[model samples]
Target: MITFESVTKRYPGGTVAVDALDLEVPDGRTMVLVGPSGCGKTTSLRMINRLIEPSEGRILLDGRDISQTEASELRRGIGYVIQQTGLFPHRTIVDNIATVPLLKGWPKAKARDRARELMDLVGLDPAMARRYPYQLSGGQQQRVGVARALAADPPVLLMDEPFSAVDPIVRATLQDELIRLQAELRKTVVLVTHDVEEAIKVGDQVAVFYPNGKIAQIDTPQRLLGDPADDYVENFLGFDRGIRRLAFFPADGLDLQAGIVLGDGTTVEQARRAAKQAGESWVLLTDAGRLPRGWAALSDLESRDGREMLAQMPLAPYGHTFRVGKDSLRAALDATVLSRTGLAVGVDDQGRVVGVTSYERLRAAIQAAEEAADGQGARPS
Candidate 1:
């Protein structure tokens, strides 16, 4: 556990960057510090590794005061990742990752072996091991940086705006990668970011900072969105707080219409009957494996007289699907909007369609989730 007891960072001119701030980062959980420019989020992160020493008070790792340890030795024992990667230009990817282990007097071959293991762990190609930093893309470089940080298997990891340098698509991929890594590694993490959405997506606990080096609120992402502590934190979350809150609610319990689901080999009459039973204008047709094929209109099925298969007719696109029980309500909502038939396809992990949910059902689920959250909030802490 990392505990900051009345930690303050005051400059020579008496400009306090962090004013008597007290925060606790539980072991093996992620804590994200977020705010606008000059909010001292980065200042607080740097102070953890003694990069920027506090003016007063104590910063303790576990039970020991960090000030008693030599700054270089303390940093070597902790993992640090920055936005620009900071890889040595001339070194190979494997060599870059092996820096810390080699510095700590591990054998050259053992350090390189550990580096190779970490490369695969972070989803880098084994072929890229011999490549230089300049040869890889921005996203790949960031992965290498992550691999290097975890090279020594440090207990705590500090990251500052780690994914900010990439494009939106790459940034999202990196964010997901970080979440997956955290789940597997369970390192004590302190991340500093200016993006609130990123903070919500990755943090187990989020600390929203004021401009005066003070925390406005620190809470879980769900609670932070459902109930903002003040106007500053509320405004920081923006107008999409309600939508963002849906991320916490699972989509598994939604009432899906399975009656309108038909096999590709189904007869025209069967499709019409299924659609009528489900009170839907269209029927979803699936292949023999239960994978979504497309949507077949009931009117089109009715035009055919015989026992013709629904597969004979032209079908509309099914848009996208969300993993039921695995994805959040927000993902289901996105699928609903993108669908051509105004229904979200819920699928299993194998991408086989299980059922379909309508917008009305999703709306009801959201209301129920909000009501439950409100009920919980009314009770004493």
Candidate 2:
């Protein structure tokens, strides 16, 4: 656990970076410090590893005063990752990951072996072990940096905008990877980021930093979204906070209508009759494997002269599918909005369609989710 007791960082020009801050990061959980630039979030992170000395107050690491320890010694025990991964350009991936372990007097073979293990742990292939940093992609290099941090098996990890340097797709993949790693390793993690969405995605608890090194609010991401502390925090969370809040609510038990679904083998006339019977303007067409094919409008089916194969007929695209057992309400709603038939397709892990949810049903789910969150006095974690 890390405890900040009235910690403050004052510059030589009498400017305060962090002012009278008090915070606690519990063990084996991720705590994300997030806010706008110059809000002192980075300063607070640096102070934890003594990269930036505090001008006032004390910081305790597992109840030991960090100031009493040597800077290099303290940093060696805590893994740190940054936006621009400071990898050694001259060193191979394995040597880079084994740097700290080698410095700490581990045998070269043992350190290299540990590096190989971490390479696999962070999703890097063994083929890249001998390659230099320049030979790897931006995402791959970031993985190497993470592997290097975990090479020594540090109990605490500090990350300052670690995924900010990558593209959005890669950034999201990295974020998920970090979450997966944290679940397996359970490291005490304090990550700093300006992206509120990223903080919400990865943090167990999020700290919203304000100007002058003050924390505006600190709470779980769901709680923070369900009930913002003030206008500033709410505005910083962006205008789509309500939609974001839905991400916490599971979509498993959502009521789905399968009556509107027809198989691809279903004839155009059969589809027309089924759509008329169900009173739906559109019918979802599925394949023999129960996978969603597309949507067939009732008018389109009716226009056909005879029993034309539904598979051969023109159909509206099925935009996307959400995993009913795995995805959230936000995903289901997104699927519904993207769909041409105004219905969201719920699928299992194998991408086979389970059923469809309408916009009205999604709205009811949202209301129920909000009411449940309110009744519990906190949103789902």
Candidate 3:
């Protein structure tokens, strides 16, 4: 556990970087410090490892005052990862990962062996072990940096916007990798990021810092979105917080309608008659293999056209399918909006459309679920 007791950092210019802040980070849980620039988020993380000293007060690592320990020794027991990676340009990937182990007086062969293990743990192929940092991609280099941090099996790990420099796609992948690693290793992680979304995605607890290094609020991601403490925190959470919160609510068990899905090779006469009989403006279509193929308008196929001509008419494309009993309410809502008919499609394990649901129905279902949960919470245990 990390405890910050009235810790403060005042620069040489007499400017306060971190005010007398008190915070507690639980053991084996990730705590993300997030805010705009000059928020002293990075400063707080540095203070943990004694990279930067506090001007007043104390920081305790598992009850030992960090200030009492030598900086180099303290750092050896803690792992640190930075944005640009800070990897040695000429060092091989294995050597880079084994840097800390070698520094701690381990045999070269044992260090190399541990480096290989970490490479696999971080999802990097063992074949890349011989390559230099310059030979790796941005994402790959970041993985090396992480491996280097874990080399000595440190219980505490610090990361500063480690995935920020990469593209969104790669960043997401890296985020998933970190989540996987944390599940397996459960290090006491303190990560710093300016991206609120990233903080919510990865943090067990999020600390929103103010300009003067004061924490505006600290809470779990769901609570932070559902209940913002102030205007500053609300504005930082963005305008679509309500919508974002729906990710936690599942779309399963909501009222869904089994749709009229006509398979391919069904004649225009058959489709027109089906649409008229069903009283639907559009008929759901399936490809030759019974998979969803957009929706065909009843009016477009109403002409005295033959099967070939009807096949040529454009079918409005639908959104991706939401799996019943699996996906979130947000996914269901998005699927409904993306479809031309404004109906969310639910699929089975085989990827076949099991049913369709309307937006109004989804909203009511969510409301009921919330009410039930609220009622349960109100009941005495």
lDDT of each: 0.92, 0.92, 0.87
Each prediction's TM-score against the native? 0.91, 0.91, 0.85
lDDT of 3 by residue, 239-334 (tens): 998887777678885787654577777778888877778666777777766677777888788765756534566888766789877888888888
Instruction: List all candidate RMSDs to the true structure.
Output: 2.4, 2.6, 3.9
Residue 107 alpha-carbon offset, candidate 1, angstroms: 2.6
Ranking by TM-score: 1, 2, 3
Top lDDT model: 1
Once all C-alphas are superposed, what RMSD does model 2 give against the true structure? 2.6
- Which ranges of candidate 3 are over 4 A from the true structure? 259-290, 296-315, 369-381
For 101-213, candidate 1 gives per-residue lDDT tens digits of: 99899999999999999999999999998999999999999999999999999999999999999999999999999999999999999999999999999999999999999
